[model samples]
Target: MDKVFIKDLEIETIIGIFGWEREVKQIVRISLEMSFDISKAGKSDLIEDALDYKKIGKSIVNLVENSSFFLVEKMAEEIAKLVLKNKQIKDILLKVEKPGALRGSKSVGVNIFRKQ
Candidate 1:
């Protein structure tokens, strides 16, 4: 399947199990790889024939910014569900990362793959 990817999308939100975490917004880096067919768009060179990634990104930002989730796992699942709402999407690979979450690590996070 043809793939469309969005990388290093950073957003601030309330996410974590700690009391302080809930009280403050933290930055989370999200990346997504979507399985889609690009043949029609490539052939016609028209945006109307292609998947609208900007719209998808905006929707994800809205969802994450308004949510207060304790785990990246749940966040990822929710994101997958939202993206999968588009019947044209065959599946998605999503990654949600919290930078500086661990003392010594650059980041900690979850990677999930979901199919429509």
Candidate 2:
């Protein structure tokens, strides 16, 4: 399958198990890779014929920013569902990370893969 990606998407939202985490927004980094057929778009050279990464990114940012989640696992699931709504997508690879969530660790995160 052909591939498309949006990387290092950062959003601020309430996401954690702690009480303070629920009260404030924290930064979450996201990355996604999905199967998309680029043949038509490549041949036609038309934006309309291609999967719109900008639109997808905007929607993801909106979803992450407006919603609260206690786990990156759940957030990744939701994101997978959102992207899968596109019939052209065959499968997805998603990563969600909470940087600085661990005191001494750089980040904590989850990765999920789903197929249609």
Candidate 3:
């Protein structure tokens, strides 16, 4: 299957279990990989036949910015579900990283997969 991916997508949102976290927006970095068969789109050379990545990106950004979650795992799962909603996608891998969440560690995050 061909793959459509978006990487290093950063969004600011209120996410965390702590009260302080809920009061402030933190930057989260998201990476997504979705599987699809793009042969038809490739042959036809039509934008309509292919997945609309810009739309997806915008949707993800909106979803993240407007929503709050306590765990990165839940966030990743939600993102996977959103991506797999597209019929063209057979499977999805989503990674969300919360930078500087832990002292001395670069980031803390979760990686998850969902199949359609």
Q: Model 3, poorest ten-residue lDDT window? A: 79-88
What residue pairs are clashing in model 1?
none
Clashes by residue pair, model 3? none
Candidate 2 residue 35 Cα shift, in angstroms, is 0.3
- Which pairs in model 2 have colliding backbones? none
Name the top lDDT candidate: 1
Q: For residues 5-78, what per-residue lDDT tens digits would candidate 3 score against the true structure?
A: 99999999999999999899999999988897888899999999898889999999999998999888888888
Summed backbone clashes in each candidate are: 0, 0, 0
For model 2, give the 10-residue run with minimal summed lDDT.
102-111
- Most TM-score-accurate candidate: 1
Tell me which of candidates 1 and 2 scores higher on TM-score: 1
Task: Score residue 93 of candidate 2 by CA lDDT.
Answer: 97
Error of 1 at 4 (Å): 0.5
TM-score to true structure, per model:
0.99, 0.97, 0.95
**CA error at residue 4 for candidate 2, angstroms:** 0.3
Indicate the TM-score of model 2: 0.97
